[model samples]
Target: MKQLVKFTTGIILLLTASINGFSQDLHFSQFFNSPLTTNPANTGFIPDGNYRLGVNYRDQWSSIPVPYKTMSAFGDAQLFRDQLTYGWVGIGAVILRDVAGAGNLTSTKGYASIAYHQLMGNSSLLSLGFNAGSANKRVDVTKLVFGDQWNGKFFDAQVPTAEPMASSSANYFDLQVGMNYAYFPTDDIYINAGASVQHVNMPRETFYDGDNRVPRRYIGFLNASLKMSDKVILNPGAYYTRQAHTSQTMFGMNAAYNLSGDGNQQAYGGIYYRTNDAAMFMVGYQLSSVKLMFSYDATTSSLSAANSSRGAYEIGIIYTGLYKNRAFSDAIRSTFCPSF
Candidate 1:
């Protein structure tokens, strides 16, 4: 336990140190792992035969800088079943880009996973999942320029110039393990809790010096949904993430209300605040089988003074597919769908 604490502390320090130097690090969407882009455990959280498709876009500090933009699209569905317990498998990918005053970088990661769910009780399930993937990080050196005052100085060698600058890319494998516990006593109420660790082996980041490895990360989340009436449901969720010496926590609540007489459509609104990060507001809508979500963040930290009210924006979508009818759906349905 002491070793673990020490390790965790070291990682958090590194993360904070890095962030302080850059003024801002690559910002993950405020929703973070909820959309399944950051955690493997979420890959097959929805019922069998149900598919999840989502996209998130964020533009930060639009007022004080060129704006840091990040976007990700991911889709996952369960596949296969086991005799004693239900089993699921899924795959997804995400791409992120960052542009700052003197540097521009882009990264993409792809993942595939298999999960096993066991019935813990009459109304609860415990799932264990494993994910494997590769990430590519690249930087554009030519787009960088340094002051001429550094001419003939050692620092000049480290500085990049405008001649189509130099560029470097690195590919590294990533692994994540996660577990989730969910219980539903009634269709109208449910609770979910989960934890996941990313960058299992601490993949080396060749994009920087010393082949610095990306530090491992630990994330935990809890979400609950309560049906208030035939037309409305309230969902509250909390997320905590730690990397290097820094920790971030987000807490928020959202309400989804059914629209239309048939209940085939719905709309949701919510707000969230990340510790020392940003305050955000979001809305979403579901039309037939497609669900779309959007969010905007407001900077509240000291940096806000320089950046203004401009914050971040995110958009996501989810599509539900009928499993019993489609061939691929039928295959997975027969394997993972619970009989009970």
Candidate 2:
């Protein structure tokens, strides 16, 4: 058992170094800035819809033992009108679980945001948003074991070490700011650009053996949609991120076919590819007040040899116009509760 654990740890370390000279961290998607996860500035940016809901999941390095997996769920909505301008608020929660070698780590975070949107010109709008929240992290010491000091005992047994006395958990505060600009030069085309920074205070956490701190992250994205015809459109997008001493840039283009529908609703199918990541295919359908989408990612790296092309899967859903087309469900309730 000791030898097996040691081998597993070594293999994981080697794989991590091979990928980017460090272990992989939790990331929502290669498609980061879709008015969902990237920036608070995107909250309630959708037209006519007062609310939205979304969820995403990721699985990585299946070839290795104890592969990494992540899941996230989020929602946002518009609040009310102030004269010609509008005010909106959003809330999101994320849970991350990482399994590498003999250790397991988990992080749970919740955030709330407020945003204001105002018409800029004849065909443009400007949005500014701010977010504040708290994050909690926990590490179960019993789950981690050193290769040389294991005797097949498990579950609350004395580890013969005094460093980590009990299961450790801590909470910290975080802040974020963002801005977005959107333009619709024509009735059939739209373009948007945005930038966001998270963890402005650089929260410090001591949940692990080393100095485990939540690093400040920056993200930027650009998106454009072009109408090819009455029944087709092309949506191209790019997302860039820098976090924890690592930087990545992803660019992808997707073409969506507008299936026949009525009254501000449609269905679409798209294919996209990203640099240094995977090729993705997506299909989505929108009806009356609900939208659903599914996507599959295919590995395109040398690690493809191990997983044999299977990579990640994601599903998302959104609903709008619940509260008399004025505000979101939670926002409406909160207006009365006044304490949540």
Candidate 3:
């Protein structure tokens, strides 16, 4: 039994590494709320925030036997800020976990980040940021089926599988850096853009004794908000990422309605199209500093035949407000650029 467990674990680990080396990282439909995962520069960025906290959950590919599940939690704080004078400094920490596959492969990651912002104009700024972390991956072999168990059209546990295994788990250090720019032309307009490079050091990530490095990933994104009237606002954005030979692109727009013309209590809905993959529908509500969001994907690709177009469902919640900085009266009303 021990030998069988080791053999199955080895094969699962090998496959996981091969897939991870080329595919982009796990993603969330409400990517905007999970700021730190997208870019380090997003940490502690709110209009005039003292601190921000967020939690996210995702359930993907329910059509399959074993679904992919993820959960994340993070917090960020403003270490220093200077109205429109000397820019600012911020710091944050994040932890997330994901589990998938018939073998129940699991991954856990934790990271800390810091960023510095430089004033560009009266209403514009540029930010540079860095993060360091560790990722650990493991697998359970009890649920796996071995091909060698098949003998003359029937499975036989007495037969020797003869599979060799080196290890069943591994951990690797990870690093990323990013740059972001934001411009608030008026009370009604906001524009922001950024780029990031992940796995820059390409540390070893294989479970086996051999050396295998995590591939480098490049990401780019932009977002904007336009106020059309006292009750209506428009938000549009796009995000693109590439890892080794695999790439993904997603674009969409959101229509938001202000309930009392103050822009504090709001509701929004949108459709996002994933290139050659699926169309995602999202809806959310925001009251003052708290937001609750939900989304579901309608598969449109070749996989639709197997799953009847049902994909993933996701949920996100966040809270952002001032815990300090009581000096500036207008600070809370400031229009700042968050990664969202």
Best of the candidates, lDDT? 3
Off by over 4 Å in 2: 1-10, 13-25, 30-36, 85-102, 147-167, 208-212, 261-265, 322-340
lDDT of 3 by residue, 1-340 (tens): 8656544554454455446543457778777778888888877665536788999999987765557899999999876564434567779999989998777878899999998877666678788998999999887755555679788787666666654546678798999999988888677788889899889998787656677787888888888888788887788999988888887899998878887667689898988988987899999998888888899999887555555677889999999887644443343334463222
| Structure candidate 1, residue pairs in collision | 11-244, 11-245, 12-244, 12-245, 12-246, 13-244, 13-245, 81-335, 142-164, 142-165
TM-score of 3: 0.88
Model 3 whole-model lDDT (C-alpha atoms): 0.78
TM-score of each: 0.79, 0.77, 0.88
Cα lDDT, model 1, residue 124: 75
RMSD to native for every prediction? 8.8, 7.3, 5.7
Tell me the TM-score of model 1. 0.79
lDDT scores of the candidates, listed in order: 0.65, 0.63, 0.78
Task: After superposing candidate 1 on the true structure, give the runs of residues whose Cα lies further than 4 Å from its correct spot.
Answer: 1-18, 21-34, 47-49, 81-101, 146-167, 325-340
Q: Number of the top candidate by TM-score? A: 3
What's the residue-level lDDT of 178 in candidate 3?
A: 92
Candidate 2: give the clashing pairs: none
lDDT at 274 for candidate 1?
88
Model 3 ranges with Cα > 4 A deviation = 1-23, 82-84, 152-160, 328-333, 337-340
